[model samples]
Every structure is written in C-alpha cells, then in structure tokens.
Target: MKILDKYLLKTFLITFTTVFVILFFIFILQTVWLFISELAGKDLDLILVIKFLLFSMPRIIPLVLPLSVLLASIMTFGNLAENYEFAAMKSSGISLQRAMRILIIFICVLSLVAFWFANSVIPYAEYKFINFRKNIAQAKPAMAIAEGQFSDVGFYNIKVNKKSGENGNILTGVTIHEKPNNYGENKTVIKAKDGKLISSEKSSILKLELNNGYYYQDVTPKKYEDRSKLPFVKSAFKKHVINIDLSELNKVDTDQESVASTNGMLNVSELRYTLDSLNKNIDNEILSFSENINQRVGITRTMRAVKPEQKKKPLPNNLLSLFKKNKEKLELIKTASSNITSTIYSIDTTQKDLKEKQRDINKHYLALYEKFVIAFACFLMFFIGAPLGAIIRKGGLGLPIVFAVLIFITFHFINTFGKRLSQEGGMTPFMGAWMSSFILSPLAILLTYRATNDNGLINFDAITTPIYNLFQKISKRFLPSQNPQ
Candidate 1:
C-alpha cells in the first residue's frame, strides 16, 4: 500500500507540473496579446516589459491552476486505467476510494496553497501591476498619444492625423484645442500643417512647435445687438509654440496604500472591513435621506390641536362669499401638491443612488467570495477529472484535452454568468460566487460512482439507441416506393 501511494503521488506530481507549465505559458501569451496595444510603440526597455509580464503572472495563476489540475488528473488516471493498472490494484483488494486517498490529501494541500496565493500574493501583485502600468504610461508622455486619436495632455486635447519621423516626434495635420482660463470667453483653437514635440528629462515642460498654423479665438460681444456680429480673431502664424506642464508625470508613487482600498488590492480581512464600512455608509445615507424627506414634508406623529368646542358656522348665502372662502384653501392644496411631487422626485433619486451603492457592495462581496471559491475549484476539478478519466479510459492529451477544455469552459461560463447576475442584482453574491462549484460537484460525484462500479459513465447506449430508432423510422417514412422493393 505504501509503494502504491508513492507511485501514485509521483505520477500525479509529474503530470501536474507538466500541465501547469503548459497552461501557464499559454495563458501568459494570451495576456501579452490582450495588452499588446498598451505596451507596443512605448519604446519601453526589455526589462520593463518582462517586469510587466511577471507582475501579471500571479493573477493568471488562479485561473491556470484549476485547469491544470483538471488536465493532469484526467491524463494521469486515464493512462493508469488504459494500461490496466487499476485492474491489478483491484485484484489486490484495493478499492478505488482507497487508491485515491493519498492523492486526495495532496490535492487538498494544493487547494490550500491556492487559497493563500489568491488571498496574499495576488493582492500585492495587483497593486504592483496597476502602479507599474501607471509608471509605464508616465515614463514616456509621447506614448500616451496614439495615431489618429484625441489624446489629452494636461489642459490640451490634441489630435494628429498622421505621425512620422524616426522618433515619432513629427506630427502632420495637427489639431490642438486649448481650454480657456477664467477670463477667456472661448477656447483657443489651433490647426497646423505640421508640428514637432520637444521634451527632455531635465525640463518640466513639453513644448510643441507648430509650423504654418492658424489660430482662432472667439470674442463675446458686450452689447446684445452686436451679438449677431459674433466678434472673433483669426490669425495665421508662420510659427507658434505651445507649452504643456509635465511636472506631475515625472513623479511615480510606489505607495501601495494609494490603491489599498481597491477591490483587487485588498486581502480577505481588508475586504471585509471595506464592505462593513460601505454598508454603514449606506445605512447612514438612507437615514439622512429619510430625515430630510420627513423634514421637508413636515411629517409628525403628534395629534393636531382640537378647537375648544366651537359652534358650527352657517354656510355663506352669496356665491362671491363662498368663492372667497374656498380660494385660500385651493391655493394651499396646490402648494402642498407641488411639495409632495418634489419630495417624491427627491426620494426617487435617493433610491437610485442607494441601489448603485448596494451593487458596489455586492461587487466587493463577490470579490471576497471569489478568493475562496477559486481555491476550492482546484479540488473540485481534480475530483471531476480523475473519475472522468478513469471512466473514459483514454490516455494522453488527445481526448483528455478536449474534455478538460469543455468542462473548464462550462465552469467558467457559469461562474462569469453568475457574477454578472450578481452585479445586476439578479442573484445574491454568495450564490453567484459558488454557482459553478455547486453545479459541477454533483456531476463529479456521479462520475465517481459510475467509474467505481465499472458502469458506463454516460450510458451512451441508453441515449443513442432511441435516437437511432427514431432516425430509422423517419427514413422509412420519407423514402419513395423504391424502399418497398
């Protein structure tokens, strides 16, 4: 039994390592592709790019590990079953459950490690990745400008129709919209045939030198009758220089505390604290809103003062007198109605804001639950893959990869769909987080039972036989007289 355990552990580890590396590489490549636009044309050093990729790896691990476990378990168990090793173990009176005991322990440990990685390591990585990207953006101010798009640099919005030159410093068909200061009546617009950017590490300003440009500035007329004239100034300049302040971009802050409150940057404890704080804030907001509404509407539980046994007044005989008596009451009713309408509108706005805040809270809860749920997925995948492999008896990557991908896709889809539902308030955070595992666990158990009993995993005959018969009947009914012959 000890020999068997050692052999099984050895085989599982080898497969797990191989699958993990392959999946990690594939996912990292995918990550690179996803962010290529951000990293490309930035003239970043090789080291910075590598650092970006490295920082991204921790986030990928949580996604990759479970799929690797699934693939490894399937391939390992399928090879054993295909080679008749399971039969030999059974002949020696070893039950399937007993055979899996050691491997199960190993998987549980892996799950715990996964949890620790998600809770501790990934948060730090997330913080680093975010700040690293920010640093990259700030490293080269020119990188922020893409060809044929509006780029915001300080107070100006610039658009370039074409870019050329070795360093991409030369811009053609340049358009710059300069925002106005407090005293300026309208924005200053500049269009140039060509422009060149000049900046240096020592300087705290970016200078754009424009050639053959036209500047237009609108002027507001002081008199109403003169407004139709729409006074403005348009001037053509042989050369013009625009200065942009870059002092803020030169500094990169590495303090993690700056982003500590973000959902992805916090550990479980921090997440819980943030969630509690948000809920308390929401409660206070609701209480304050209610109080405001009560004050505005003059709501009170106290009874109105009773008149001291006053005699009933006789009705007014004249129409003018009656009209005068009711006019004051009608105006009071109109004023009360308007106040009620305004209060209702205010309440509606408050409810919308409260709902948005609640959704944000749900998002935090989902993130909190995801840390644990993703870790537990490793164990669940192993259970599912091992039994499935044993039942299929197909070794190697051919069939196992297909099954692993299909199962993983199904799991991922359910998880993503549930998360979206939670975000939209269609589902509770807990239910959304665990929905995939809840669905797959029962299938894992069923597969295990069928595999252990040596019964067909899918009962293909039961499903296919009826379909075949139905096809045959359809064919006979559709055939011509030649079918009788």
Candidate 2:
C-alpha cells in the first residue's frame, strides 16, 4: 500500500475500534439492567454472567456494526478535514480518486465480515442465548424459595419461616396456599412443620415433600358460585409429595409450531418448505372432497332405480327392511355431501389464509436477506468517504466523519422504512429492502465526483426542509381539532 493509503487505513481502524468498545460496553450495561431480575438472591458467579453476556453479544453485534462503521468514518474524516491534511495531499500529485481506492478496498473487506457475522454467527448466538435463559428459568423455582420470604411457584404460594445452610435441603415453619385451576376444581392448602426439596436419582421429577402437615381441602365443587360457606376437611399426613415435570423447563422454540415441524426457525428454506406444504395440504383436501362427492352421487343413483314394484318379489323380513333402509341411507349421504362441501369451502378459505401467513414469513426472510446485503454499505461509505476527504483537502477525523455520518444515517433511515413497509406487505420484498440502496448509489457517485473535484458536499437539505415544513404545517392544522372530537 502507498503511504497515503496506509495512513488512511490506520486512522479508520483506530476510530472503528474505539467506537466498537464504547458501543459494546453500552450494550453490556443494557443487558445487565434487563437481567437483574433473574440474578436476584442467587449466588451466581461473575463468570456465569459474563458468559451470558458474551453469548448475547453476537446477536446484537450486527446492529451495532453498521453504526460503528458510520461513526468511525465520520470522525476519522472530520478530523482529517479540520487539520487540513487533505489540502496537503491534494497539493501533492495524489488525486482524490487515487487516495480513495485504499479506503474503498478496506470497506469491501468490512462488508464481507459483516455479512458473515450477521447470517451465521448471530443466528447461532440467538439460539444459544435462548437456551441459556431456559436453563436458568428451569432452576428458578429452587432459587426463589428463600428463607423468611414468601415464594410463589407454579400454582402454590408458600412461605418458610427459617432455613438452614445444611445443603439447603430442608425448610421449617412452612405455610402453603394453593388456588384451583381454571376448571373449578377444589384447592388443597397445607401447613407443615417442615419441608424438603428432593429429586429421584434416576428420574427427572422435582418433588417438594412436606412432613408433619395438615391438609385442608373444600370438598364441594359447585359451591364456588354460591356465597354459602362450605365445610372443609382436615387430614393429617406424615409426608406429601408435590411432583413437578422437568420437561417444562426446556427452552421453547417459537418456530416449533406445527407448520415448522423440525426446522428451528423460519429461515428462507423453512418459509419455502412451509409454503409448499400448505399447498399440498390444500390439494389433498380438494381431492378428498371430490372423492366424497363422487361416492354420494353413486349412492344417489343406486337409490333412484330401486323400484318399489320390482321389490314385490318374496324376500325375508330382514332383507325387505334392509331395502327400506336405503332411502334413509341415501338421505344421510346427501346431507353428508352438503356438509362436506361446506367444509371444503371453509378449508379453501383457511388455505388462503395460510398462504397469506406464509407470504408474511417470506417477507421476513426477504427482509433479513436484504438487511445483510446492506452491509455492502461498508464498501459504499469508503467510496464516498475517501473521495470527499481527498477533494475537500482533508485527511483527519473531523470533516470526513461528519459527512460520512450524515450519509450513513440518511441511507440507514431509508433502509429501515423500506423494511417496515415490506414486513407490512405494503411493498414488494425486493423493492422495500433494496430500493433505498439503489436510489442512493447514483447519488453517492455524484457526491464522490463533486468531492473529488473540490465542489464541496452536495447539500440536499433544502429539498428535505420543504417536506419537513409541509408535515409540520399539516400536523398543526389537524392535530388540535381532533383532540376535542
């Protein structure tokens, strides 16, 4: 690399790293705030918390990277411009376009890296983070039942007056209150002298066994609606078991819906597969309906020719009754055919709805694909940034950074709006995600040319100001009247 190119890269790298660290720290702080609830009253080590944060970092890194790059470029070029190093470079034989080639190359590399991280690393991190949370939640019940505090686990609200550090295996002075499920069944509340949490050696059951307990239960199930008091029975027991299913502790994968089957989430391939499956189901349903209709038509024809006169031949009473039963059978078949037709229509409507849902899933993957593609903006920024710096006769972090940030923010906002439109099914997937980039490409080229020729930054703020003013005036005119109405 030439001296100029090497110098530009060094400035870019330094700025990028500094911004990345700050952003990463901010993300970590946000996470700590979010998960503080889960970490309460537990002897959770720092290593475990750090591991969770690290696992989460990749998932959010894609979002942060683009902004970081934008900031780095803006600051790097802005400083260079402020220092007038760009002027010195221009005074030499180094042209603006020549100087930008190195920056462009650097951006290309960054874009590729961003793409890899977003598509692969981020998805895997999301999966792990979800599982980690589930594992923690599974252990929450034990952690929740602290000494001298009321704890609610599942359906039971219980309190323990005191607990010893002896393996945390036993509690004393236990009081329990249980509420019936939604089905109006009676609830049993138990008061015990002590309780212990135990697990079977070979099974996945978590058992809360209480000792020396008197259980109180309402026997009358129907008396919940009436205000009349119902008598309760008190039974003494030496031990009682509250068994819990451990399988409920597993992390729930949202994509494990029936439509998804085995595919973890609705990726591009999964969306396509689901669409095909819905189509096949619809076809099969139609074919089944057709066969049923044909059978009904055959039954109707067979019954039509069953002549009453021909049936005068001597026949056993059972046989004659059997012939008579054909009429009712035919009528039943006709009713069934009508019901099937109605059902077929309903299925058709349902299939259409499923197709719409599948389309929505497709829209999401399309957006994801497009967002990854926008990482190529890393490359584009270099094109715009490098040339602007050279033409403005600057090489420092000051002016280049400001210009880069403005360009990136404008493009970023446009990209976001387009994606939302796509997700809402307002715009075609390609158009919504890619159109902003396409529209800006030519504009970026123009800006690069002007900057290379020392024409200064192209200010489109005039055009935007008018649109903003128009919205402001419209809001002022209409917003106030609607409030009273």
Q: Which candidate is the best by lDDT?
A: 1
Q: What pairs collide in candidate 1? A: none
lDDT of 1 by residue, 16-126 (tens): 999999889999999999877567766777988988998899999878999999999999999999999999999999988988999999999998998898899999999
Native-to-model Cα distance after best TM-score fit, residue 339 in candidate 2, in Å:
4.3
lDDT, model 2: 0.66
Candidate 1's TM-score reads 0.75
Per-residue lDDT tens digits for candidate 2, residues 284-400, read 766775666656446454555788776767656653356457788787666666666655655576667656665665465563665456476666655555555544554344655
Off by over 4 Å in 1: 145-203, 206-244, 253-257, 300-345, 461-485
In order of appearance, the predictions have TM-scores of 0.75, 0.56
RMSD of 1: 7.7
Mark the regions of model 2 whose C-alpha exceeds 4 Å error after superposition: 40-43, 142-244, 247-360, 367-371, 384-413, 458-485
| Candidate 1 lDDT score at position 43 | 78
Query: For every model in order, what is the number of clashing pairs?
Result: 0, 19
